[model samples]
Target: MMKRYTLMVAGPLVLLGCAGPLTPRDTQQAIRQEVAQAAQPQPAPHAMTDAQAQAALLPPLKLELPKGAAEPAEPRFDLAVNGAPAQDVFMAIVSGTRYSMLVHPEVAGTISANLRNVTVPEAMSAIRELYGYDYTMDGKRIVVRPLTPQTRIFKVNYLAGARVGSSDTRVISGSVSASGTGGASGTTGSGSSQTSLETSKINTTLNSDFWGELKVALETIVGESGKVILSPQSGVVVVRTTPRTMRDVEHFLKATASAVERQVMLEAKILEVQLNDGYQTGINWSVLHNGQHKYSSGANTGNFDLLTGAVSGSLADALGSGLPAAAGTTSGIFGLAFQTKSFAALINFLETQGSVHVLSSPRIAALNNQQAVLKVGTDDFFVTNVSTTSNTGGAGTTTTPSVTLQPFFSGIALDITPQIDEKGRITLHIRPSVSVVTEKIKNIDAGQAGKLTLPLASSAVSETDSVVQVEDGRIVAIGGMMKQSFDDSANRVPGLGRVPLLGYFFGNTSQSSKKSELVILIKPTVIDSQADWQADAEATQARLDKLERQPQTP
Candidate 1:
């Protein structure tokens, strides 16, 4: 007998050894399989490590640690006593302000296989036997109290695999934890840990495919009736629904993944560019003449015939020589001859100042029952202001000269068409209706003749301008003196005081009854020149005639 002695081993033991090395081909094959499986897809992928997940999921980005910075060794936890070689085990370490994790499928697989048919308490017991730690669930949180005085709390969510059939089963677990302090200065924390073991095949549905279907629906609906405004700075499309209702939101989401898509497309098709520019024209007129005398008095005071002859001679000279040739043509008159010296002086002043553009012209109609049309043109002529004055010599010898005066004033509208040629220019055409009232005051001195006359008592003038763009609009009852005068005695008189102490009064009077009123009627479209419309037509005909007269090329 050769000392036949044998020793018996006790319980289960794990021999610590290096993992088997994987060949390059084997590693490549495994990686390809993983890539193919992941490409099949389900939910959006979670692209973060365990540590990164915890940092992102945590409320604040800070952690607290003990006074001195000390790094702890990696934690090692046991999974089973007699576990299979290919089992998987997952571990998380919390040290100071840092959290890390390690996974070992060999250990995890061993534990899963041994506890396949075990109860929850038995599983817990097995875990304690291997790692010397205990775990308990408090609602959704898992509480792991170490033997040390430091207590740590962990928030966890777990999902157990569903039973598919009698022959197939799967299991999974996940947990997250925090320890030390609260708030931003809290100590190290670990995200939920997860474990899964399955004996059945899984059928997954791809979410990308579902989203693709939704996007197609959205594009169809938005193509029909949708309007979008987008910000140039940010490429964000703000979405709005048709009729802006809850139903529209639902419709949009079901059809399109986002509203921004519609906005971007709409913004690309808008036109961006500005068009405004033109000229204006206007016309005015005044008439000055002498009325015949009613009766004659004395020879020394001068015969009515002699006075009338003097007045007529003076008027003929002034109207014939003083007035411009253009005025005669427009007024349709060979000349305007008044039978009064006062009227001649008035015409002289007006013609010298170019204020006699339309005074008593051939263009003016006769004072007959038939209406006469006066055609005004804006081609080379424009009227700005009009005025008149009359003075009569005292009867026989002059004590103080008897005077009668009238003045017409207005603003001239100039042609701005050259400045802006695109849009039509503005032009003003005026037609005046005149009514005169003369009153004679008595109590005349021996050398004086009693007389009171408001020359431009009441007048109706119509002004139309294309530049004003107001149609059928007429400025009526337009009457005022371009120049006015006041005697030094005006201050001595109460009612006449403060009547523009000196110089001309260039504005309208304050008296409502005496003031001018205008009624403007606007047309949908603008006209070039209301005053010159007919004149322009005639001018155009004349130009065509002239052109026809010129020799044509053979």
Candidate 2:
């Protein structure tokens, strides 16, 4: 009986020890235990020896980082320290990484940091910025140094040259003439007279001594303790100065480089408009600005007097604005400036005025504060002066006429210099000139019966020089340069026209006066980068392609 009771109790214990189906609550408990085990802190990373670190470290890459590049991913770590030596903290940050550090003996300051999920470089940078600790890294070794004078090299990309520019503009009015008589008969009388009148004059000069100025500025900033070495030929500068002063120097150089490296492309179109008798005053800019050919632009129209044809100031004002005073007040060229990006629209607008003729289309590029010139025409040699020299020789006494020839450019010429400001405004010095050979007769007295008739070169020139401020991609216009011509035509039978005396009776003659105005438009585009330059080149190429595809004319 006793043995049966023992076996029954043992059977119940065995049944209790047997496995059963798992419940949802029991599985949740097991998952919780596993998550708790995973959340525990991981073992510290193993420190590496110098050789091991050097073997594992990658060679430093000398690469140019693109602009606005994001920071690269790095291995992160957690740090919690209080009042630890800076050297020890730095050593700890670089431990287990592919970097070995050497701290200066003077680096004895204490560092307190509680950073988590921070990278090695980030931790070092934070400590340096906060504690003024300077450091430099080699391929696999980092050297921490105390605040001291350090030598740094800088690159200054500028030409090793100086430029000096000067311009003088003067205007004079009226003229004076004097007659002198000298007689030789034992008594001689001579008279001399002179007159000078300058109504106004303007002078502009610029001296750009970049290297000298930079050296002076750097030396001043460095003072006596620091040193500055400049080599403009190679566009390099080396300085030994404190960190704070070095930072200031860097900032100054950055600003200067940005300012000096800017460039601009200048496009000019000089056109002639033949008035259709109705609009004889000038190109009606009001039509372009407010009428049917209204172009979308960010132009300020308050300074322009397009309507009512109001004259401002005097002839001086016209001259100062780079418009020839010969055009007269009735010519109506004043404040006709427009800002737009489309050259086609401007040409279409000009067609509405009269018969449009493109005189010249010139394009050039210039750097900041640099001058660029475009000349498209022929330089013809013309007799400017003639002198008669008499010589008494054994052969005979003869008078020889000595003629001097001078080259006269009879086409279009444009001279421009641009100064760009930080706000994208461009100040331009514009000098545009147009010249054409005119047919005229000149008579000179040769102390003989008839006279000396020489075909002198008579050239009609219209030129203007002025300084103006304009926005980028804006079109500045100068007009009111007018040319007048007279044409006489006769209609008759060919055989009847041959009779000189009676031809007038048989043929009828007609005379007409044709007047035309010249207009100059200039547009400046700022090129901020190489991409902009390449884009312009591509556009020019496309234009050339289109032109080439057109049918050839004989």
Candidate 3:
């Protein structure tokens, strides 16, 4: 079984509620009542002082004090005696377990004279200031009480005023003891008495320059005291009084310094990055650059599927395979795994060859707030057919001819338009044009954008084929074309139009043909009409202002 410990800290003893707000007459009455009660003569508790009462309510932690417990020549606090002759005064320094109390006494001819003249209200106020509590007077006794049950140990040291003619006067006196769960540490009465003089000197110095020289002093002390333990949970250093070897002390100090430095650096870096961008901006490069490639190529007749596999594999190896593959190769009814490893390798080679440029840039950085457009060029369509007929009269006659229109290429131009929204979303629109065919014809003139339209039933043309739509504002489309021809007339060589050499037995003939072709054009456009970067800028400023007004905590 594991042992568990929980530290429950008590709150300050200051009471939130007070006697109802007193009127001027009520205040006078209360003061008179207190003074009348203090007028009665009462015996002091055995060797106990008002300082002791205040210290009793605090925690059981020893306070560090100043060096040399000797009294100063002159006190700095006010002193009084029996409501007259405020001359004989002494300064006292008092310390107890977990508390320190100070008192300056006004000397009277006797101790009774001093006690009788002390005003209860003044004493109560002084006690409250030093110990953070309240007090009341009963008859001749001034009863000092904590405003609340909770008490926090505090270390205090102050100088007081001196008496006019007393060198043996006590300048200050105070005491301290464990306030809660006094346990074994409380039993050691001399624990408070055995105050290390050096520790007190260090504490005094620490109070004046807490943020500067104190850090250096802490480092030095930790180095000298090997028994110091750094508590991560409490964010504090616990020092034991036991002696240790110099080497051990140095080791402990070094470890503590390293831990502190690391924590500070980490926190500073987090704050800096947060100011510029979001937390995700700090992601490791390995994740972002994985599976990126530059270039790939293969023979025109080579299997497209195999080439795709090789390229993908190379990419996978170069960028690493932590992520799933985004591209693949396909056979008629089957597919192959084409990871980025192969693709990356090919891209690397091509980059070295200067054939392509691979950015290898962070995807999020490139696309997080950017927009781009892509254009796919135009396409053309064409179709042609030819036939011949001949006639013979008296003697045999024959004719042979051929007409052909070859399709060099067929394509449709696609223009993609892109638009970006406030949240970095993209939309695309596309426009397509008809396919064009260029070939030699038996009887057509050159340098002409030939117009040929085939029969509607035989042509691959439709309204839907003219345009393509993309989810992200991208588009593609195709155009239509058709061609046909026929012979019009044929006759025997009995006519005058047929000469002897050109027409056997004077034969006459004529033929007519029809041709059609389709041309496709693609145009893309981008629109940023709806975007309002000015509004975004204003919102960002407002967010920053709100953050600035928030309260900060340590």
Candidate 4:
């Protein structure tokens, strides 16, 4: 007998060897057997539909591990599926693992998955993450369902100052008419009299959009049962819709209100300088040709007259003493009459010192208190290079690039609109556009307006927009322009003043310098109707009268 050797170790041992290659037919049979074996991996206790999964649930698997023995981890899956229902993908992922997955009927969608050696738990987590599905684990079973859509309520305001009732609702008023024929008792001429009362009822609501315009645009998305509530008196618009639809409604409201609202007041301070401490400012200004021509007009105040520091009047009327109004120019704010005439007064004051210029006048396009449009005209110009390619002679043939001048006119136009809320806060939308007028090379036969102009221009627009929220009655100041003035003069004895180099000693030199800042202050308020402006005027007059009646203290 040959000598036998025994080997002892902490574990068992086995012999390893490489297997010989099999024929194509044999390989096919082998693959089929492997797939058949895998088909029953992690077989469920019983087959169940999504609806029945909850009722015929998988019983908890009670497992016990020996002391000092390692617990088996979740099985990994190498699954790949193409254009399969989500349920099938989940089934593939859960096969061969300790986990069982149940997909609710609401989770209806197709899935294409490529998983590489991923654990069952990891694969389940990824499936939920990618699809935004919600899942919960019960023992070794996982339940999944699609998230339901959420609902939200949004609030906005329009037509502020109207008296909306406690319920924030309004009723429409209709007219009632009464017509009767006269009955003759004796020798009475037939006659008819009609009486009408201006009071009736209807169902209607108004907003900056006027008659709930956004409602129609959102109906398709919000569905037939969605609700839009309008409170005219409180200026509040309440929208109750799904989260996705609410977003669309919000976008619609911003656009619709921006197009038609206007009513904004700009309080501007225009000042000039005389000396570092002593200043002379009595000026009124105007602009022509879209802010190109700017000039000032005022009265003469000799010797830099001293002024009383006590300023109690409006900024417009502070310097009204020596300046005369320009012809065709009105004295009130934006051509509107209020009790206080301080705006013109301020213009009068600015003209006395130096040349005053109005770079831009506030332009109002729409005046809806709930929404408004404020604009300032700005213009710019530039040139751009053009390049073109063509197949002229033959296949790869090309011509030399030609050179030409192209004139382009670009201007800045700011369109600002605000969405007012119930608390008087505003979500301001500012659209700043660069309007381009491309100069088109035209024939001489074009009209005079086009002929005299080089490269006739066609209008186009490019815009950038943003939103900023601010409270009502707040002042926003825009400032950039600064001016510096230097005044130097000398009074000399008549004959000695002409002496060139030696005249320095005969004359006195006086020099003074002054600087000023240009500022524009914008204040927005909600006015449902013109009556609000009238109320403002009456209130101003009352205050002024009250001041005048009070005795002054020396």
Per-residue lDDT of 1-554 in model 1, one digit per residue for the tens? 33433222211222224446789657756765554444442443766787888987885856876587566643343334354322122231122213332322222223332445443345445655555343454442334433221222111111112112111111223334432322233222222323343332322121223233433554454444543333323323343333223234345543332221211000000000010111001112223312331111110110011112221222224344433332222311111212222323433433433433332222121111112233223222222222222323344322233333443323222111101113332122222222223333333243454343332333222222111111111111121212222333211334344357532233223321111212121111222333333443454455445665789777
Clash numbers, per candidate: 40, 0, 81, 27
lDDT of each: 0.29, 0.74, 0.29, 0.47
Per-residue lDDT tens digits for candidate 4, residues 1-554, read 22333433312343323445789658756755554444433445786678678655765577877678587866665777777888777777777667778888877677767888888777777766566555678989998765555444445445444322110111223444443333233222223333433232222122344545545665655677677666656556676664445656778777766544535432333222222232323112332212333222221111111121121222224345332243123222111111122444434444454445553444343343333333344343432322333334445545344334654446544455555665655444443333446557655554753542234556554332233343454433222224455799888989997799878888898997665534333344556555555555554455545665789776
Better of 2 and 4 by lDDT: 2
Task: List the candidate 4 regions with Cα displacement exceeding 4 Å.
Answer: 1-419, 427-470, 478-481, 500-502, 508-510, 537-554
Best by lDDT: 2
lDDT of 1: 0.29
Against the true structure, candidate 2 reaches a TM-score of 0.65
Whichever of 1 and 4 has more lDDT, that candidate is 4
Ranking by lDDT: 2, 4, 3, 1
- Give the per-residue lDDT digits (tens) of candidate 2, residues 248-310: 788999999998899999998998888877777666655564453433223222122333323
Q: Residue 48 of model 3: what lDDT? A: 60
* TM-score quality measure for candidate 1: 0.12
